[model samples]
Structures are given as C-alpha cells and as structure tokens.
Target: MHKIAMAMLGVALLGACQDNNVMPGPQDGRALFMANCAVCHGADATGNGEMARAMAKPPKNLTLIKVRHGDTFPRAKIMSIIDGYARSKTMTGPGMPEFGVLLEGDLVPFDSGDGIQTPTPRKLVALLEYLESIQAER
Candidate 1:
C-alpha cells in the first residue's frame, strides 16, 4: 500500500543520512524531525519542502519562531500546535495532521499546583526540542 511504501522510503532516507550532521542521541531529535517533518518542513525546516508546494496553504517557516514571538521561543504553543492541542492561524487547511499518538511515549507527570497532575508524552518533548534547535537566531 502507499503507507507501506512511504514507511520504507523513510527508513531508506534515514539510513542515507546517518553519516551526516544528524547527531546521535537517546532521543535523536534530528532523526525524528527528518522522519516525520522533513517532507513538509524541509530537511532544513524552511517550510518550502515539496509537500508545501502542493498545499493550498504553504507550511510555516519553522525557522522564524523566535523572530515571530519577539525573540522568545514559545515552547507550550509549539507543542500544542504540533499535537493538535491548538490550531495555528497560518494553517488554513488540514495540511498539518495531528501526530499525537505517534509523538506519545512514556508518560511524564507535571503538576500545576491543582489537585491533579497531567502526563506529557516523551516523543512530543523530543520533537519540541528539535523545533527549538532549528529556530532562527534573532
């Protein structure tokens, strides 16, 4: 099927880039980005990838987050956008799909001083870190 072919292609591409600047880590944020985001965000996170060309609304310029938010990176907002917790205004269509289940890993607990706590997914954290790393300098 198409999904199977795409998965195979992704593995091949990841293998091809193993020797490049993609750093190795327990989480390997760059690998995650390349696997899940590069098709739409481009390998450099410039938002001009081929998928963006096909979209009615071009993908966001991922590199400019810092510039857009007054030189302060909005971690919560970025994560929300990625997991579909929040919808970004720039996305005029359903071009960006929710990767919530794909981004889920071990649950992490966080308390907001209320009677309850929320568990955050680890892969989401890794993806957020990857996005933060690629932000353009202000």
Candidate 2:
C-alpha cells in the first residue's frame, strides 16, 4: 500500500512536468538503458557489465527475464526493483540504484499484469516496455 501511494504521488508530481526531457518511447529506451543501466546490466542486457566483477552479487542477465519467470515477465516486480521500492532493507550487497529521475517525466497507465490501472511514470513504463522487448527464448 505504501508503495502504491508513493507511486501515485510520483505520477501526480510528474504529470505537471511535461516539459522535462524524457525518453518514454521504445525508440528511446535503448539510450535510456545505456545511460542508466548499461554500466551495471551491460549494453547487451546481460549481467556482464564492466562493474559486474565488483558487485557482491552479480547483476542479472536481463535478456532472460521471461525465461527465468516461467516464460511470463513479471512487470510489477521488475518495475519495483528498478524503481527501488520493492527491495528489502535486509537485502545485502549492492543492487540497482533507485532511478528517481524516471519519475520526473509524464504519467501513463500501466496494469502491471493486474487489472488495476495504476498511473506510472512515463519513462519507467518505457524502460519496462524496453525490457520486455528484449526477452530471449528459454
């Protein structure tokens, strides 16, 4: 519930900032991923980024999300992980940084595979869409 509130607040705040520079389309997702995630997740969407060796737990092989999730990509879970609200405090080692910047653009409706029409950050939604697009076969 707390996460939902926070996400809604972000959506409301971002709704007013339409002029902010944002990459909220699949065409721009590759650049967005490179700028923010490539250093950790790799340009190939594999776990073998340059920083992979340094982390206590290696980054995930992003290309295999669907394969790992029973051939169904978990959208809400992945979104929370990327936005930094789903990880627990007891989680040890380094993880992906909270991309607050993703919440500074526009708002879009995302179902997260659920029926609820949660308002989501446009950029974050774009990132999610991009991740889904790169899923490899099991």
Best by TM-score: 2
Query: Model 1: residues >4 Å from true position, as ranges?
Result: 1-27, 88-94, 109-118
lDDT of 2 by residue, 1-138 (tens): 999999999999997776544436666577789889999889998988888888988999999999988999999899898777897676556766777788886677778888997878887888888998899986
Clashes of 2: 0
Sequence-dependent TM-score of model 2: 0.78
Across 1-138, the per-residue lDDT of candidate 1 in tens digits comes to 999999999999997775432222334567777878889889888997768888888888898998999998886678678777787557665578776565555654433235355565656666777787777886
Number of clashes recorded per candidate: 0, 0
- Candidate 2 lDDT: 0.83
Quote each prediction's TM-score: 0.68, 0.78
Query: Which ranges in model 2 have alpha carbons more than 4 Å from their true place?
Result: 1-24
